[model samples]
Target: MCRWLAYSGSPILLEELLYRPSPSLIDQSLHAQMGAEATNGDGFGVGWYGLDTTMRDMPDTRGPDVPVLFRGVEPAWNDQNLRELARSTSSGLFFAHLRASTGSPVQQTNCHPFRHDRWLWMHNGLIRDFALLKRDLALAVDPALYPSIEGSTDSEVMFHLALTFGLTDDPVAAVERMVGFVEATGRRHGVEHPVQMTVATSDGERLWSFRYSSEHQSRTLYVSAAISTLRNLYPDNPAFVGLSDETRVVVSEPVGSFAGAWQPFPESSYGIVQPGDDVIGDFRPREP
Candidate 1:
C-alpha cells in the first residue's frame, strides 16, 4: 500500500502540510501508522495548483495558475531536492504521495499523483489481480486517450480508464465504471476480489475521494473534520484557528491524533470536497 494526502482551501505552504504536523506525510513515508506498509519508499510525487513557478520545475506548465506535477523515483524522506521544492512551493489545492510498488517499476513515471492535463489522481490500494486485469483495462481506455497512458502502474491505468468512461463529465460515474470493469475482468480471470482502492483525484479545484473494494475491506481513508469543528474542539490549537472554513484535507490516515480532526470514510463510500459543503455517501460500482 501507499500513503497520500490531498489538501484544498486556504493557501498553505507545502512544507507545512508535508512536514509540520505530527506524523506528517513525510514522516508517514517512514512510519505510516495505518498503511499496509510501515515505510513507502518505492517512489513519491506531488501535484499542486497555483504555485510560484520560479521556485520549481514543472511537468505540465499549464502556467502559474494551473497545477504542476513533480515526481521523484526516490524516497520522499531521502530527497533533499523534494524538501527544497516543498518548502518553496505553496498551493491552495495540492496532493502529496509516497509509493510502495505493488509490482510496478520504481521509476519516475510510476510514481503516484499521476497527472493528465488539469486532472490529478493517486491511489492507496491495488487492483487485486493487476497482471490479469491490466491488459483488459488498458484496452478499455479511449483510443484517443490510449497514447497518453505513459506509466505502467494500475493507479495510472485507473485514471485513464476513468477518463475513458467520462470522468470529465461525471467523475463518480466514470469511477463506477472503472471499478466495475476491474471487478468484471478479474472475475473472468478467476480472481475472487478484484478491487481494493482508496483513490483521490482533483481537477485543480474540487476534490474527489473514493474508498471501496470488491470484498468490502478497503484500505484506510479519511477526511479532516471541518475546520470550524476543529476550532471548537481545540480552542487553543493554532492549526485549527488559522484554517479557513473552506480548508479541507483527505488522507490515507490522519496526520495526528488531534481531537475531532479526522473522520473515517464509511465502508464502501466516496466523498467530494469543494469550496462550499463536502459530501459523503454510499458508493456502488456500475458497468462501463
Candidate 2:
C-alpha cells in the first residue's frame, strides 16, 4: 500500500504540507504511522496546476487544464530535486503520493498521481489478484484512452478505467463503476474481497476523495476539519488564521498531531471539496 494527500485552498508552497508539517509526506515516506507498511519508498510523484503562463497573448482566456507533473523512481525523502521543487512551487490544488509497490516495477510511469487531460489521480490500495485481472481490466478502458496506458500497475489501470467510465462527467459514479467492475471480475476468477483503496482525484477546481474495501476493512484516510471550523476551535493557532475558509485537505493520515485538526472519513464514503461547503456522502459500488 501507499500514502497520499490532496490539497486545495489559497496557493502555498508545496513544502508547507509536503515537508514542513510534523510527520509530513516526506517523513511518512520513511516512517509512516498508519500505512500498511512502515515505509512507502518505491517511488513518488507530485502533480499541480501552474498559473496559465500561456495566456500572455490573450490574458482573458483560460487554457487547457493540463496539470504539470514531477515523477521519480527515488524515495520521496531522498530526492533532493523533489525537495527543491516543493520549496519553489506553489499551487492552490495539488496531489502528492509516496509509493510502496505491490508487485509493480519501479519506474517513473508507475508513479502515482496519474494524469489525463484535466485530471490527476492517485491511489493507496490494491486490486486483489491483479495479475489475474489485469487483462480484463485493461480491456475495459476506452480504446481511445488505452494507448495512454504506460505502466503495469493496478492503480494506473484503475485511473484509466474510471476515465473510460466517464470520470470527467461524474467522478464518484465512475469510480464506483470501476470498483464494481473489479469486484465482478475478481469474483469471476474466484477471488474474494477484491478491493482495498483510498483514492483521490482532482480536476484542478475540485477534489474528490474516497475510501472503500470490499471486505469493509479499508486503509486509513482522514479529511481535515474545515479551515473556518478549525479557526474557531483553535483561535490562537497562526496556521489557521491566514488560510481561507475554503482550504481543505485529505490525507492517508493526519498530517500532524494537532488536536481537532483532522477528522476520520467514514468507511465506504467519499468527499468533494469545491468553492462552498465541502460534501461528505456515503459511497456504494455500482455495476457498470
Candidate 3:
C-alpha cells in the first residue's frame, strides 16, 4: 500500500537518506522494487525532531520533544518543496512515507507519517475489511484523545488506537493489543485475517518497527547492516565511509543493492532501534 523509511542516529541532512542513496525513498516512491505495486504516488509525508534547544537553566521536563512535520498531496518524486526541505533540513530521527491510496482520499490529510505529541507513525499495509472494523476500533480510542484525530484513514486511526492501548508506556504491548483488538473485531464481524502491516512508530528517541499480519504473511521490511559491518564490507565505498556507528535505518525495501548492507526481517517480527545497538525478534498477535 505504501513505502516508508525510518532513520535514527546522529544528525544528518534529510537528503542523505531521502535522496542520496541509489534506491532512496524518493526513488522508491516512483519505482518501488519490493512493493506489490511499482508506484506509490498518491501522496507523501515526513516527520522529524530537531535537536533539544531548551536552555539548560530552564530544564524543560515536558514529554519528548514534538516533531516537525511536512506532508503533501503531491508525489514525493516531484514535490519541489519536499526536495528543497530535505536538502536543507536535518534531524537525529525521522520518518518518511509515500502513499498509494487504497480507499482514502488523495489529500494532504490522508498522507502517511501521522503525528501525535512526540510520536510519529506510518504504515505500509492494510487492515483487511477495515471498513467493517473502523467503527469498533475508533470507538475503542480514548474519548479524551479522540478529538485530536484530524484525518479519515485507517492508518491514523490505528495510531490513535495504539495510544489508547498505552503506547507511551510500552509500544510493543500497545501494538499487540491493537492488532489483537482489530483481529478479534474482524472475526466478530465475519472478516478473515483482519490485519496486514509493516509499521514504524517513534517517540523521537527510540524507533519500533513491526512486520505482522493475521495470516503471518506481511509486507517486506528490512534493516540496514550495522554501520561498522558496512564500513568493513566496503572500505572504499563513499556510501559507508561517512556513516556513524549509531546510524540505523529501517525501510520497506533496501535503499541500495549492496549484498551485506541489508537484511530481510523474518516474517512475523519486529525491531527496536535507538542511539546504539538495535534489536530484532519474533512478533505474534495477543488477546485483545
Candidate 4:
C-alpha cells in the first residue's frame, strides 16, 4: 500500500506538512509505521491549488487556477527536486503521495494524485485481482472520459471510473458507485475481497475522503482534529500558529504524534471538508 495526505485551508508552505512535522509525510515515505510496506519508493507526486503571486494582482492573466502537479519516478526521500518544490510552493489545498507499486511499473505517469480539470485524486490501496478485472472495469468508463486515463495503475482507473459515474456533481455517491462496480466486476472474476481503499480527492475548493474495504479491514486513515479543538487542547503548540479554524487534513496515517491531533476515520465511511461544518457520514456502495 501507499501513504498519502490531503490538506485544506490556510495557505502555507507545503513543507510544513510534507517535511517539517516530526514524522512527516517525507519521513513516512521511508519509515511508514501503518503502511503495507516500510518503503514507498516506486514514485511520488504532489498537487496543489495556488496562483502565482506575481499573477494574483492581475486576475485575468492568471487564467484558470487549476492545481499544479510535480511528480517523479524516484523515491520521494531521495528527490532533491521534490524537497525544493515543497519548500517553494504554498497552497490552501494540496495532496502528496508516496507510491509503493502493487504490481504496476514504476514510472512518472503511474504516480498518484491523478488529475482532470480542476480535480485531484490519490489512493492508498488496491483493486484486488486487478489484472483479472481490468478489462471489464475499463470498458465501463464513459467513452469520452476513457481517453483521459493516462496511466496503467488501478488508482488511475478508479479515478476515471468515479468521474464516469458523476464525481463532479456528487463525489461521495460517485465513489460509492465506483466501488460497487469494482466489487461487482471482481465477483464475476472469482475474487473474494474486491476493493481495499483509503482515497482522498479535491476540486480546488472542497475535499472528500473515503475509507472502505470489501472485507471490512481497510488500511489506516486519519483526519486532523479541528484546528480550534486542537488549539484549545494545546494552547501553546507552535503548529497551531497561522492555521485557520477551517484548516484540516486527511492522511493514510498520522503525520505526527501530537496528542489528540489525529482521529481515525471509521471503517466504511466518508468525510467532507468544506466552507462551513465538515461532515462525517456512513458510506454505502451503490450499483452504477
- Global lDDT for candidate 2? 0.91
Task: Write model 3 residue lDDT over 55-136, tens digit each, in one string.
Answer: 3355445534888789999889999999998988888899999999888899988898998889899999888778888888
Best candidate (score: TM-score):
4
lDDT by residue (tens digit), candidate 1, 1-288: 999999999888899879888879999999998889999999999998884746557454465555688999889999998999888888889999999999988998899888887899999889887887788889888999999888889998999999999888899999999999888899999999988899999888799999998989889998898887888888887877767899999999989768678889999999999877788888999887
Which scores higher on lDDT, 3 or 4?
4
Give the poorly placed runs of model 4, Cα more than 4 Å off. 55-62
Candidate-wise lDDT, in order: 0.88, 0.91, 0.88, 0.92
Q: For residues 196-261, write the lDDT of model 4, one tens digit per residue.
A: 999999888999999999999999999999898998998888879789989999999898778899
**lDDT ranking from best to worst?**
4, 2, 1, 3
3 against 4, candidate with superior TM-score: 4
Best by lDDT: 4
Question: Model 2, which residues run further than 4 Å from truth?
Answer: 52-64
Model 1 RMSD vs true structure? 2.2
Model 3: residues >4 Å from true position, as ranges? 51-64
**Clash totals for all models, in order?**
0, 0, 0, 0
The TM-score of predicted model 1 comes to 0.95
Report per-prediction Cα RMSD to one decimal: 2.2, 2.2, 2.6, 1.5
Tell me the TM-score of model 3.
0.94
